[model samples]
Target: MTNTPANEKWFQDRATEQIHLEQLQRAERFNGRAAMLGIVIGIITEGLTGAGIAHQIGLGPLIDGYTACRTQFLPFCF
Candidate 1:
């Protein structure tokens, strides 16, 4: 039997949804791998530098500078 218009529309919708889902899954897998790689790099750098991840990335100094600037009490800022 030939497919009805309604059946064709439904099939098209399903195909579109499947494509969208596959794209999302691929993007998620890529993001996860990138995150893992970043973590590994950070760990290696920390080991070599003898510094915590935050300090290695300058996050510690940035936060300290921000806090000092906000409080206007610390000797160093920025």
Candidate 2:
């Protein structure tokens, strides 16, 4: 039996492809977890800020004032 260089090259190529695929899967899972954590932190931060603002200027009045200003003010900020 003769072992050819072409056969060796084919095996090496397949091994490289598999390693790259594994690395890609690991990166995707890491990114997904990071995104979920970021979203949770963002929600908590927004809730805390809103609560602090309400406490400073009465909850009911603050909400009413925000509702009134939002229609006119949000467009410019966005």
Best by lDDT: 1
Give one digit per residue, the lDDT tens place, for model 1 in 1-78.
999999999999999999999999999999999999999999998899888788877699777677778898776666
Q: How does model 2 fare in lDDT?
A: 0.76
- Model 2 lDDT at residue 47: 88
Candidate 1: worst-modelled 10 consecutive residues by lDDT: 69-78
TM-score for all models, in order of appearance = 0.74, 0.60
Clashes of 1: 0
Model 2, poorest ten-residue lDDT window?
Answer: 49-58
Which portions of model 1 miss their true places by more than 4 Å? 62-78
Estimate, for each residue in 1-78, the C-alpha lDDT of model 2 and write its tens digit: 776999899999999999999999999999999999977776776587764434444586667567767777554422
- In every candidate, how many clashes are there? 0, 0
